[model samples]
Target: MFFSKLVMAALAATVLAEKTPVTPLLLANFERYAAFASAAYSSDCANPPFNSTVVRYINDVPTDTQATLFRDDIAQQFIISFRGTSDIQDFVTDLDQVLVPCVAQGIQCPTCLCWQGYLIQYNAVANTVKSAIDAGLLQYPGYSLVVTGHSMGGALASLAAASLDGQGLPLIAYTYGQPRTGNQAYANLIDSAFNGTMYRLTHTNDGVPQIPAQSDGYRHHSREYWQSDDPPTIENTFQCQGQEPSDCNQSEPGYGIGNGGIGINAAHLSYFGISTGNPLDPNAAC
Candidate 1:
């Protein structure tokens, strides 16, 4: 354990140094990306911001998981979103925490290992999501891709972002109340791929990110945007030092572990003061 901490300390230093060079985040964009994350819950996608964008499709054929694809011609971006846990299937997905090989075609992670359930969630819609993204890109040339999700949807967003990285597509991921999706190698893969563009936001006392337990061989990727105080605001948020930084959300005992890795807590429910819905309506049906 001592030697492991030393290694992680050295790696954290290196990751932090290189992290300064990535694209700058616009605080205003947090609200925008968050809007998309929340929109994933609305069944009809008739929410305010979503209503304004060109809706591509909402893939929920499995009913267990759902992802949304849309185009913002004004911003010239193809945005994809996944809804948080609203079904028993998603809870089952979250509980199936066994580590597995990330062998999804196009992902270059030869040695990477990921949480089984999260990868399954990603695989469920990977083909359709990619196809929609490809079509959207072709239709709107020069537009980049953005992926956002809350809770389990956040886990899917990470997998989707990694998948996009494999395709060498321009992309960014903003996930709220996300869990640890993989091991150190998997986290490193994502950190290297997006540098600063991977916004893994954690709200105060959010239990989700605390498990698939780090003790179980899962490690979060570099950088964490933490809301250290309640009533989350730009002023109260802090960009943490490195992957799994102790000074940020890691400072508090999260919701996931206390419930034995299941059950929803308030912090995991609403991000940026928006109700992402409960188990009854994972998608807000907006």
Candidate 2:
């Protein structure tokens, strides 16, 4: 009985040691991203059918950071997209003049066509993230920074992650339904630079990530990809039908899919509270 009681005490201690406290810096980062979403959704460039849809999409997706009290303390930081300000004619002219040629002759050039527009938008978001970091809004020095997005947002997150990595920052990025941004060499470089920080999530039937340049060297992370058949729950179903959602089934014990792994539940929108199984130890620096 003493031995069993001791084992139980040890387990309790382990659990207590693992609990993470929510920090103000983390809360600031969440608010910063929220502002980014609000601004992106409100942008005039977020036009027509997409504008409304994007707004709702941003609103519906959850963040792990919101569960903490820090949510109320951070100052709001709003970002205005250049695309939102540019008239359609000017936007097209800029795209034709600046972005199109970047991917024109590449191996993934054909597939990159659609991403051209998204790249421009991502640059804006990256700038926003950088600005926040620079201003000391997000002050954690050792925390792992992850940039993520779903569908087009995933592409944007990829670019943002790459941009941050280039600046000699330590960060990781996981994109869902992300298109191929560049050639294999480029993708390889991104993977290496980010220390394999890039993880792509896909739903089996979701066609967005299948665009050109995606299949070459891109590595996917998910439980369904390797495990036996598990029926999708209403909570876990991908919005797009017929696609197998690449939720992070392989995440370590602390980071559960519902908590922090990638899937429809783990997409850029829902990352804040996804348990990640590895709950942050409150005693540790936030």
Candidate 3:
């Protein structure tokens, strides 16, 4: 009887913790960040409701990797977002998954090896993106610097965040439906660099987050924020503490079966009750 009572008390406490109401500011930040990620899918990069405006639009013909530099004056943020897989070349980048030594100006992790594809993609635009970020910060010296994206874009943004670190600017990254980005060493480097500011948002049953499988020596940086429920509300959002959490999204049905980005489903299409990562979505620009 005593053991059973103790178990019930523990369960009750856990339930109470989950029910903690989310602050409006926190929810709005996630929604605004999602809008930025979605905007990368479109050329407008405009969001009036969030008081954001496109500062620059990058379309590198050679690499065909697009990025948007936008600012949310209300949030005091200068954000750079990457576009997800859209062309045949992007798929080629995704499949070229060889792990190579990470190259980032601010990172000095000698043993870190990241996905060759992502590194190459970041390299193509790294200088331009850095210049844009530097200009934005120079004008608005107090503003925070943010990097964000979804799907393939998210993968590149993760690398950008690592490369932007230790630059004397306040840097944070938010990635949605991002794939495994690097080997364990690279993951450790990112995990340590961002600390509390990195928000890796994964949704329920989103198979895209499962591959470049662990067997392939790919690993994700911590800490991940998983929305376990369908609508991905504050109540269901939990910060997964480890590099990989078995009881979180990784434990979802057949998630392990995802290979070569094959298990990608509708969950990857949208985030936070809105459709994101779609290039043609008419509302994505808002």
Candidate 4:
């Protein structure tokens, strides 16, 4: 009985120790790390700072799915960074926004209809991650896992984070310019699952975050961190209530699809300090 009690105590302590807290410094590093992983989808970057730490890369092709696993022995951390939509099929997947029953294993799940394409793609990427994580557990016994991505990749990261959370793994996720992933039910489920561990960031007038349209019963995760068009600074941000608010992404009028050509393009591409160009027209959406 004494031995069993000691074992239980040890297990409890391990669980408590696994939860990694999010800080400003950590978020800044993760945002850059996620960008580097996202770029790997488009370019062959040479001698990137994160290249040395990539223990595994999951690229499930003839589809736009890619992820990188960075294991830092010095910090004892394991991070899974997902790549965003890269091609026509990916954009087609995003626009094919039909929500069907989120059923699995012969049972009807609460949420009706997840994004069919994204869900299919996310599962493929997640299968690879699951196998990698299982092996990583044996290799790096107490390492914490952090997941991050941008745009469509961010949506997939959210799904992956929630699914992994089910296995009792402590989750820390950071996603930028993420669109609404699912219906209200799906959002509710994931929000509660990742409650404090997820930080979903949306820059000013980012139309991507304003979609897959809340009018269709789609919703965002709670406590969204809204960065401003003014300038990138920690002081120039706001954590909006629930999903939409006057001060966040929904602040602008119209469908939030953006107005002019520059506006539409700028809204989607400017997150993480990657600028498309300054508008020839001063009034272009920021």
Model 2 Cα lDDT, one tens digit per residue, 1-286:
9999999999876644432222454333433333332233222323321122121112111110101111111222212111111134323522321224223211232322324565545443444456555443354343344455444455555656556666766654544444445444445455456543455543333333444323333332221111111232233322221112323222233332222323222222222222111113111112
Could you tell me the C-alpha RMSD of candidate 1 in Å? 5.3
Q: State the lDDT of candidate 1 residue by residue for 1-286, as single tens digits.
A: 9999999999877754442222234556766777788778776766536444635655555647788786777787878988877767777877888999986756798789988987877887888888888887887778888999888889889999998778777788899888888888999998888888899988777777777667788888976887766666666677776777765666675433223344357777777666675555544535
For candidate 4, list the clashing residue pairs, or say none: 99-113, 100-113, 101-113
Give each model a TM-score. 0.84, 0.41, 0.88, 0.77
In model 2, the worst 10-residue window by lDDT is 60-69
> Against the true structure, whose TM-score is highest?
3
Ranking by lDDT: 3, 1, 4, 2
Considering TM-score, which of the candidate structures 1 and 4 is the better prediction for this target? 1
Candidate-wise lDDT, in order:
0.76, 0.35, 0.79, 0.65
What are the per-residue Cα lDDT tens digits for candidate 4 across 1-286? 9999999999876643433333577446545554543543433334433433666778888666877676766657777767676667777888778887654322234654577777877877776887897789778889888887777778777777877776667868888778788777777776677666788877777677777666676777775777765555555555655645444666655544221111234666655454321224211111
Which runs of model 4 end up more than 4 angstroms from their true locations? 1-45, 48-52, 103-109, 253-264, 274-286
- Model 2 alpha-carbon drift over 4 Å, by segment: 1-114, 213-286
Best by lDDT: 3
Off by over 4 Å in 1: 1-25, 48-51, 60-63, 253-263, 279-285
TM-score of 1: 0.84
How many residue pairs collide in each prediction? 4, 33, 0, 3
Please give the lDDT score for candidate 1. Answer: 0.76
